[model samples]
Target: MSSLPADISLDTLTPEAVAKTIDHALLRPDMTVDEVVEGCRLCARYKTASVCVRPCDVRVAAGELKGTGVAVGTVIGFPHGSSPASVKVCEALAAIDDGAEELDMVLNIGRLKSGRTGEVRSEISQVVRAAKERLPGCCVKVILECSLLTDDEKVAACRAAEDAGADYVKTSTGFSSGGATLADLRLMRASTDPATTRVKASGGIRTLDYLVECLQAGADRIGASATAAIVDDLRARKASAPSA
Candidate 1:
């Protein structure tokens, strides 16, 4: 994880900083083109890290976000990580073709739980290879779906991702039964080498307070549909703080 700036603190957080840490999510299945466009506009306006859209929406999102400094990212296996490795690789390449600069791919939860760590690692490596081969510097985040794993499983998953050359180890898919928790975040952070693989907190991070807490707990990036609410709340707090 990139170290937080030495001088920055939650009490002095800036809206821009907070926004940059967010991957404003637009992955809901029911969202239409118009809504996706609007969400892309919001992401550009907030200057978020990216707009994580469904794979099919990548083209539109990429077009809308072009030159806006917000990247277009998409999911691979999605809420579930059961797709065959070849299929996941195909999905990753297709998303890249559609202009996605980042890929969040789900790792096989069942395989991991069954002690198939080698297979899990190899699958992630294949996706990572495909992504970088298509577009150099493409970021790959491996979703562990931490809620479904025990502590040992989570650590093993993190190691697999790291060994596979993934850029980040993500906590959850948000569509899952549970979301990111402080304990999980801390464990994920501790499991990976911070200089190599960063941790992302997704799922149920709706408020500015909780977002900040995640940051403190070791989240380098956050995925949330509540981008506006969180950023607006930060702005409001900054506005109301007495001038130094």
Candidate 2:
């Protein structure tokens, strides 16, 4: 994350700013290549931070968004994090080779729930290592799937992510029972070093108002498929706001 001036306020955030904070989700398994193309176009048109797609779509997304400034991102462990650490590492490596600039890897929820903190941290670290090894500039966001965890577990997950050298700690997988909430975002933000590990709110953030709330709560990015609605509403609000 680039450094912004200290006085920056959410109320004054522009469409460009909002777009830059979004990772336009295109990860549904049923999505076709044509749909992925269209989604990439929308991300490029909006100049979003990236187009978060499934691992197999990394190359296509990268090709579509080439030279557009928007990046190509894909999930590592994905909706479920039960994959072996080696598998996650291989996925990260393949993703980077396929032109992914960012990787959102899911934490092993069952292991985490079982108090296997070392294994969880080790797995995250391994994937982070694989990503950074293949593409030194690639960013990794470790998804905690917060809705299924207690507040204490959430904090623990944030710490584990930070310890694992992840660039960010994300709130949810969107496949879980619930998605990101302002409270979870705030807790994540508070748990990690903001300068090093930023917060990404994912899953249920489909509205302009909810996006604003996430930002206010210190989320640096929003993972959503409802990109059009959020961007449209932001533009309309900006257009109607009283002039200074």
Candidate 3:
């Protein structure tokens, strides 16, 4: 867990602080183009870190968020991590071309389960290369879907993502049986080189309490579809608090 102040209070939770930690998720399969556009507007209004949209919505999100200071991001290999290395690479490239500044790609769960760690690393490396090569500032996050892995497997996946040059190691794709957990976030943060890699917690985290717990667990970013409500709660609590 991060060394957050033991007595952290609502008074200290500014909108910018909350917003910077969020990656407004817009990845629901049934989400319409208009919804994605509106989501981008919300992201812009909140000054959130980015909008994590479906691959097909990257262009639209990028257009909607233009000059908003919030980045546009998309998923690669999506809820499944079985896509071929070449396919993942193409997906990364296309997303970049469509104006994505960040990519969250799922690692090959099957390969990792089968003990083909090298192949998993190779695939992550390919996508990382494609994203970084095309856009030097683009960041790639490898989703390990921690709910399905043993603690050891989770560690191994984090190491593999680091070796493959990923900017962050994320937990869950939200389509999985479980989402990010504090234990997983702590393990991921401890496993990686903090200077080079970060941790992102996603899935099943909708409330402000869960968001704070994830951050204290060392998560640098969060993926959530309930961005507006959470931040609104944060603001409301801060406003209702007695003056210090």
Candidate 4:
């Protein structure tokens, strides 16, 4: 939704070779409306691809960014995907109503680990249905907390998210013990079918180097609180390079 051009075929935005890899995240649980408004404003000012925030402020963000192209996104199950199916649906519906253009739901890690892949898949599908029904045309990203899963489980989750109709398979909730790793990103990137799915790298990504790495590893988007710093770093690097 960011006006910065999601497609990089022409490559005119940033020259880091991966400007699209950075998504400006504002998922503070206690972020106030005024703060969200300001936070989203900052994301737009910096030309971030998207702004991911808590559900409570999705509508406010959407309203604030009508023409900015900066997408409005929110977390569904959030750090824990253990909520019941009904609960996740309600949250997704509410977030859409509040103007979220995208939903990032946490997968039921426990259920998946407990051999409840069916239930996990169902939960994600239902949430996706709810989002699409409400938004009509929108995207849904499922957070798998990849650090906790075995490679096989990660692959299974990626496939499940794809089958469940999620637009992207995300790395973490930023509340986990670890965050996106290059290895995990690569594994997931290759695991998901690129034709119908994407990889979102979030959680502990706070540098330009990491951002570039995420993009090269097949990340379609990034979730970071350090958006300004990264962009500034890109600008600085460009400014210091000798003119050809």
Candidate 5:
């Protein structure tokens, strides 16, 4: 993890601040509609940054979160990035039409590993273009699936995503062998220009301590299923703090 400045203190963090960093995940393949609705309610209660659901659940999530101050997001070419760019673009457009404000798209991992950086960048660009054209200010996050890549490939993937004009470069899909790591988060933060692209640490971030560490390591956002637990814990801690 990247070292924080000596003056920095996570102990002063607020629950609202922590809640805003989370993209409450509702992407489990077996999740029922009722569960998705409940998850959307959870997001609204906590005021999370977004609720990231499956493609088919975009409209459901959107309807539930409408006017709740929480955005609706969905994945494209999800766990696998083998789909053609055209397909990903179409999926992104449909997601936008369904009221999704954020699109987390998996870049073609195989192509990146195969040394086809141009192809990878091109595909990401296409999705970004299609999404932005459909909905201005729609955020796009490119998932790197870091556990499957070497440090070099991860760096290349970050650069490719940034070059393609993605808003964030995320760590994984949670279906992979591993999730976000402190080292990976630090490396990703270092690889991207902070002004244009931010880092999102996803996969296996189920606790507040680990989430704070990811933030210190330069993650601007978090993707997790434990949003309520994490935020509630932070709120409890703040409430219990001794009076100055």
Candidate 6:
């Protein structure tokens, strides 16, 4: 895993690993049920990371994807992580109530940027605690809106998430000004003592090349809106290449 000073080159990644890392996504508010159906179907076929959708559809998604390794995930503190910690926990409970198997929650970056370390950890811990208590065995991923933070602050956020018992520390909510970066992912990987926290890269990774770079930079999961194209590109390259 890459460590602090996250600036890795894209050349480090492999096409095979890239194919396994995408979280096939469709979180747009205006997304129709048909589009979601299409999205979910494609995700299942590709065997991508997860099929992230709105909180309301967790039960349906979980049901549709029964026995599939594909996970039913939803967002909390969503595009904005500035809400009261209790509110985000409640939202998590609601999503879980609907059959969510994994959670992708945005951390309170504003507080962390303001140097409120304890509060940041406290907020994350609340969600972690609630998830374990209520859902038991489900995964909780904390998104630390990387574009809004400094490198050191990014490291600190990862630590906080780990301390809070979060299963993963992720980058971006996709609503921020910028998205994932190799520098951030590498730094996050370095900050951990034991790799109890996996890294997730979300937002703006639209191409197969970008996704490859993210995986090489030590991101275990990727949240992308372009899963179809990325997978198709991989298949085309594979078919055209000489047989091994």
| Runs with alpha carbons beyond 4 Å of true place in candidate 4 | 1-20
TM-score of each: 0.98, 0.96, 0.96, 0.91, 0.96, 0.90
Residue-by-residue lDDT tens digits, candidate 2, 1-244 = 6443244455677778888889999988899999999999999899999999999999999999999999999998889889999999998998888999999999999999988889999999999987888899789999999989999889889999999999999999899899999889989999999879999999888888888888888888899999988888889987898998
Which residue pairs of candidate 3 clash? Answer: none
Clash counts for the predictions, in order: 1, 0, 0, 4, 0, 2
- Give the top-scoring candidate (TM-score): 1
User: lDDT rank, highest first?
Assistant: 1, 5, 3, 2, 4, 6
Deviating ranges (above 4 Å) for candidate 2: 1-10
Tens-digit lDDT string for candidate 6 (1-244): 4332334343333344454577777788898887787788877787776888888777777777778778889999888888899999999989888888789998887899999989999998999899889989878999989998888899889999999999888888888799999998899888865457788889899988788778778888899989878878876777686766
lDDT string for model 3 (168-244, tens) is: 99999999899999999999999999889999999999999899889888888999989999999998887897886
lDDT of 4 at 132: 94
Candidate 5, run of 10 with poorest lDDT:
1-10
Clashes of 1: 1
State the lDDT at 241 in candidate 4: 70
Q: Let me know the TM-score candidate 1 reaches against the reference structure.
A: 0.98
The lDDT per prediction is 0.94, 0.90, 0.91, 0.83, 0.93, 0.82
How far off is model 6, as Cα RMSD? 3.7
Q: Once superposed on the true structure, which residue ranges of model 3 sit more than 4 Å away at CA?
A: 1-11
| TM-score, predicted candidate 6 vs. hidden true structure | 0.90
**Candidate 2: residue 10 lDDT (0-100):** 50
Model 1 Cα displacement at 40 (Å)? 0.2
What are the per-residue Cα lDDT tens digits for candidate 5 across 158-181?
Answer: 999999999999999999899999
